[model samples]
Target: MTAKLEKTLGAVSLWGIAVGLVISGEYFGWSYGWGISGTLGFLVTTIIVAAMYTCFIFSFTELTTAIPHAGGPFAYSRRAFGEKGGLIAGLATLIEFVFAPPAIAMAIGAYLNVQYPDLDPKIAAVGAYIVFMTLNILGVKLAAMFELCVTILAVIELLVFMGVVAPGFAISNFVANGWAGSNEFSFGTLSAIFAAIPFAIWFFLAIEGAAMAAEEAKDPQRTIPKAYIAGILTLVVLALGVMIFAGGAGDWSKLSGINDPLPQAMKMVVGHNSNWLHMLVWIGLFGLIASFHGIILGYSRQFFALSRAGYLPKSLSTLSRFKTPHRAILAGGVIGIIAIFSDGVVNLQGMSLTAAMITIAVFGAIVMYIMSMLSLFKLRRSEPNLNRTYRAPFYPIVPGIALVLAVLCLIAMVWFNQVITLIFLAMMFVGYVYFSMTKHQRENAEEDLMLVGDNH
Candidate 1:
């Protein structure tokens, strides 16, 4: 039977996908994790990280506009590097997404527990996970619609919190008492920033969602670049607002002890009324669910792409009636179920932080992105005749600056969180072995099946 064509998504829908980045647990975790360093420090650090995020998005947007395929980083790496390169990119993405859902689910559980002190956190997490997984299996069109709605609500919630909280400005919490429970700056503050980098990135990583859906994007070359710019700009605006709101609400020094720093800022303006906190919690819950939905959808496409390229089970590459990669969606659900147990590894905050570290370990994605950006220069030299639509402004200089910033972020994440960094590396090594063994076995099986068919 002929395969059904996949539906194309518009630029506005893609922007919704981009905005989903802000509601993630990583964003909250970063604000909380670094809130210890005072508001000014958080602002300074976020600017550096945001700059890196912007460059990464631009480089990725250039590639997506150039190759507009379903594979996201998998397609880019495959084209630029080859099968092995593609496999690594695909594997790193799997690791990243595998850890993401549970982190979000667990965060929901944590917040819910605070609201309903009697509720079991584990139960809350499991229920949210099941709900999110169901939403994903239903397919992308539905998921995008959900994303569009949640993105709007979440953005409005962010702005409301900022506006409400901004008026309660106390210059006290803005000072430097150190967010950490330490005495001096020494290597500790630097170490905390390193630890913070991975989770900090979680808020910014899915700007490539539009790219992953490139094959299903109407006029992808035009739509994808537009989505990238819009998405990144949206993130920058919200992120900057978050920093400003957090800074203005109270003294930066006192922010160190607050775990849910955003909500804490919200409370300063709205007061400690249970009704107000409940409303904010519900909004936060929406943010968590929306983030999980986007992560699963984006990563499943990467899984489908890898399988099509022979790096994963061919079943995962199979499409359903809706042209969705149903098998990959199922595989991701199973992996996510197991990853949910990582919540058992620690409380909500620890799992979220660990997931973030695993995410940045995709130095491979950054590496591939840098190569793709450099390839822009090479392609200009080699394939000047290739059709050009939207070129990254400033050409070599923009990409060059982006490459340097990405390198710095990677180094910083690695230096501070060497343990989690090693965990991420270990996971990648396991993926390499699995890829090698599976590829060899599949090739041998195919040969045997062909021989038997011929003999018959």
Candidate 2:
């Protein structure tokens, strides 16, 4: 028998969970942008991406509140464009959640390698997935509370990282070849900025993950918007703070391509293998773990939602004794573990496994953003009588900004990582074909299961 989920999460917990979902972005992912465009150039990318997220979160909140479901964008697009549309959206989300964790896991491995060179990074990464997935399977509230606590620790470490690096900061260092050694206003510099979009968007990539928890929140209509807004604001502050301070403290280019940027920044300030740097190497992983765990929660919910709604196997939707989506969590974890070990085989064109995966994940996120915004515009005109607890501020304008920027980013990814973009499209095509053939039978089964009302 499947257990029912409890609605025990409150506003504060919701905010924490939301922040936890993407806090690691501040820690490591954004540094890759500096590799492409240097400090000033990446800053341009960050500002534009920040603007995109601001519009996206506001518009996303309205749709999430009006129809609070664990499916997140999948649920919204499903309502607006029917089952096939929903399947596409759901697959995109699955890509976002599933692919993201492997990147985080790879980052985790790189961090551990920095601290204890003897530890095989891949083994440690697989261990992390094993430990965290077990915690996720045990219970949702426990997992959420754990996420909140680790997120707080991560936030504190980021502040401490800033303090340690601040005294050494120099404006000249930040601007040194700031456009990645390109001539001023040249096509090379412009091209670098466009290529930096994925890394910039990584700064707040999964802030939308919070909305996926709506089904388990207390009074989601009120709690969902509050969490989304507060969460985005918090991330913007952290992203800029860390980026500017770290960029100013060092050459910026040296740490640009690494998975563990903060520790490298500390090394520049304090000296080689400084105790302070070594300490951060261990503690900084809390930041990665926060996102690692939180994203697991997100992907599990997405898997459960699709399964329960006839988009995937009905068996995957069944809750455990603790009322958590255990099977969903397990399934995603297994795929992630495979991705980590098989990283050697998953390369696209000339991109490294980590870069290819990150770009592919961004591809999924951008698609969902574009579709979700379209769904918001469609529903507003077609479903005038629908109850909406919160309206997106700025109406079509907010979603319009997000949609345009997302499309631009998509264009950027195609130009920069064409092979991975093509690979992502192939994945979508395969998934759509499978979903279309099985959906009707699955839908009827799902409706019947809903009537069963399983508990304990």
CA RMSD of all predictions = 5.5, 3.2
**lDDT tens per residue, model 1, 1-456:** 322227558888888876774466433555554543444445556777788778667766766777666766666555545557666666766666656666666677777876888997667777876676667667678878898898888887777667677677665554345434443455666656555555456556556655677777788777777778888887888777776667667654444433356666667677778466667777866776677778778777877766665677777767876678877877877766666565456443354533443354344445445555554555566545545577777777777777787677677766765666776778778888888788663353222211111222
Best by lDDT: 2
- Candidate 1 overall lDDT versus native: 0.64
CA shift of 326, model 2, Å? 0.8
Q: List the residue pairs that clash in candidate 2.
A: none
Looking at model 1, how many pairs of residues clash? Answer: 7
Per-candidate local distance difference test: 0.64, 0.85
Q: Which stretches of candidate 2 lie over 4 Å from their true place?
A: 1-4, 447-456
Could you give candidate 2's per-residue lDDT for residues 85-179 as a string of tens digits?
Answer: 67878899999999999889888999999867898888989999999999999898999899989998998888898898999999888888888
